[model samples]
Target: HATHCPKPFYSSMKTQLVSAIHLQEVELDDIEGGNDPADDKKDPTYTVEEAVETIGFGRFHVLLFVIMGSANIVEAMEIMLLAVVSPEIRCEWRLEDWQVALVSTMVFLGFMLCGALSGYVADRYGRWKVVVAGFFWSAYFSFLTSYAPSYGWFIFLRSLVGCGVAGVSQGFVLKTEFIPARHRAYLLPLATIFWMLGSMLIIVLGMTVVPTYGWRWMIRLSVTPSVVLLFLFWFIPESARYNVSAGNTRAAMETLEWIARMNHATMPPGRLVESAQTERGSWRILLSPAFRRTSLLLWYTWFVASFSYYGSVLSSSELLEKNLLCITDADAEHRVKHRHEEGSVCYCIPFAFSDYQTLLISCLGEVALVPLNICLLNVVGRKLSLALLQFLSAIFFLLVNICTTMLGFTVLLFLLRALVSMNFNVVYIYTAEVYPTVARSLGMGFCTSFSRIGGMIAPFIAQVLMSRSVMYAMCPFAVASIVCALGNFLLPIETKGRALLVRLCPR
Candidate 1:
């Protein structure tokens, strides 16, 4: 008898059956007798070959993960450039501190508000469509944001590009759904590593663009990733797990065969669930006792994290004072002129010219974020690590106010931003893992929406400090960070190595 499925996933029945048949055939004829309770109990038991064939963990999985990670980096570079390019932007436009902050705040605001609905649609229709929309829209608008001639157009375009991030915000969850539960913790961290690489490029751009051509060029430079890395979309396949759950047999086979070919193995033939049943999917299920509380906490966390984060970045731009430093040095303007005078072959090369140092520092900031994320997630539990970082970030915001010297201020500013960057990465991974399969999309969307609300308000908050001392401006973010840090303490579960839940709502 064919097993039944939830109404929402009714379509994936065939894919479910095929994958089941595939797994069962292998279980039935285990060459290594690996399924035994005693032998499988050992954590070290999974041989590299068996991991590839039986469990679907291998170079192929790594390849897909890397591609996804790099895609994330391409997007991140655009985001970080917002912070790096602010100095030139604020100076040229003669804008206030809040105005500069508005650029990134608006982007996140666009992401926050649109995320929930996109999550729902992805759950009902497909993950691939969501990613496709995000890519096309973000890439187009990101380029448009660069071309904006006026401050109003600049803010409008940045927020519009933010809409693109909304469509693709839950990529971690999508990747989580496709892979096995056991490897998820490690996989999530690895995927974020791509974000690190992308951020690093902006740091490189910072070294080259901001000092020489000015901040507008940094905005123009960011357009490279959105256009170039888009080619990967073709190679990116749909979620096999989503396919299996929806009962699409043909799609299941095609995706599985692709996986097999990617790994060089034979397809297994077994039942999809052996006895799994389902009913049509519904949003009501998210409010079930099992998930409601988790959803609420995640939403709140996103709000606080977003508000505090962008608040700091926007506020930091006010602190750059590089132009001040340049004025003090006198020699600085000559340096800028010297580079522009020479031009061309040396221009594109960041390290080739002297003006690129600030850009280099900004781009290198991304590298600093990498190991920080890996260590925190792997060594410390999610809750403590996030809370700790948020708390520290908040402290740095306040400390930036107290510092007397320029050198002292910039050093603390970079360090705190690095710590917060790590926290931001953790929030992405943890939020996705906390949700079950059914609510993952909406959960992500809702959480991001709250984040956008914070993003939207970050500029206003920054505006309050615009007329005040830089030290005073940071206090609000510091305070909010403390609140978020404390709230994280109440997160009920660790979710570090938990399984991806497949809740089949009974009819």
Candidate 2:
């Protein structure tokens, strides 16, 4: 300072002090490593579930939910077609009861043949590819079914439609992976409402078109949605979980990043984690000791669930036979008595129209179950909810045995359908939760194939038993419900409020 006396000296001294402070800050950042490039390259400390939760629910999830839910609509229509068109097809083809039942059987035959393979493919190749392929297969076959010239041709096309519809199972797994666990219980069941919607559509059309234009036109109309779904599915992405499970970290990262961007969220810096073991999915994995008990129980559950579900639906014709207002031979004669000479005058019972009406009533149970399921599942948990519903359904099914009047029968039918619908929702949600990511789709496929087994035989049960007595027709379904109720009580895994497991291999 004594030598400085000059202004230039003072300025130089100040600059030196600022530079020293800046260097000290740099040294501190190095010690903290906040700006270290190596830190950016480290694997993420968080899991996929954590990340998905961070991103949260938004348009991305809604798009997925709606698209997958629409897929459910096409599947619902296709599966229900056997019941909706059975009477018309039978009259037109002069089909025997066995043949009428066979129409329902063959569709599931197609499903049984292809369902496991579809699941494996989704697991190995990825979910989106199979889902799109399934859409195209279904659309083409569904449209083709309208032109079938004979019962054999009609059944063949329906089987093919089953194969196509199988994709929805995989689509369901993919959808589950995208959702945050917190919301799964609520949203997954809600998607099933589309099933109710699809069924209602079929009944509405059956009410209007089947009576006038015929069953063929009703089938043709069902094809439009599948075609629309093909376009929408193109916009969907593969599940990030599937990608990471498959070891394509880069692909998973990209998908997660896209999700983050869409969700207006931040991607944590680093790689996501999945089970390190990379064994390809195999059917055997589902039957391995660790999963063996779980697998057998699940299969049996699916069988009972499907048997009761489809048995009730496919037996609607027989149920309607008990309707107090059923068209009588004399009433039919009276309606056409004056027009005997008119070749177009018809004497057949208005089965197509009546079936449609009865099905509309069946849907009321489903509509009511929407809010009921939310409340019931939340309070009792999945295992208890399923058990309770199954037991309740058994009571309703047995009540059909003693019901002498149409009112009693209709009430029991409504109650039976409602319980079955609730049970169906619980089983599906539970199945998606118990299996690990490594074999989730395969497990679902394997279990679902057992459902097809039940579906395959249900028509026969209904055909023979319905012709005898109400008790005879309903005994098998009631028994199955009791078994399921017992099974639900015994299943150890309570999937409610649980995390999706990453690996299920033995420790």
Computed on alpha carbons, the lDDT of every model, listed in order, comes to 0.64, 0.78
What TM-score goes with each of the models? 0.75, 0.86
lDDT of 1 by residue, 424-479 (tens): 77788787667655566767777788888877777666544543455555677778
Cα error, candidate 2, residue 124 (Å): 0.4
Clashes of each: 42, 1
Model 1 residue 300 lDDT score: 71
lDDT of 2 by residue, 1-507 (tens): 637567787778888999999999987897596555666555356677777888888778988889999888888888877777776776688666688788888888888777888888888988899889988998799889999988889999989988887776678898999898888888988987888888888878778888899989999998888889889987788888888888887788788889888877887655566554376577777888777877888889988888888887777654553232223232442233211355342323446354456677887767577778878777788888888888888788777666354454556667777888778878888888888887888888887788899999899887646754666777888888888888877786777777787776632
How far is 53's C-alpha from truth in model 1 (Å)?
9.5
Decoy 1 TM-score against native: 0.75
Error of 2 at 55 (Å): 1.6
Q: Where is model 2 more than 4 Å wrong at Cα? A: 1-44, 275-277, 321-348, 352-355, 404-408
**Each model's RMSD to truth, in Å?**
12.2, 7.9
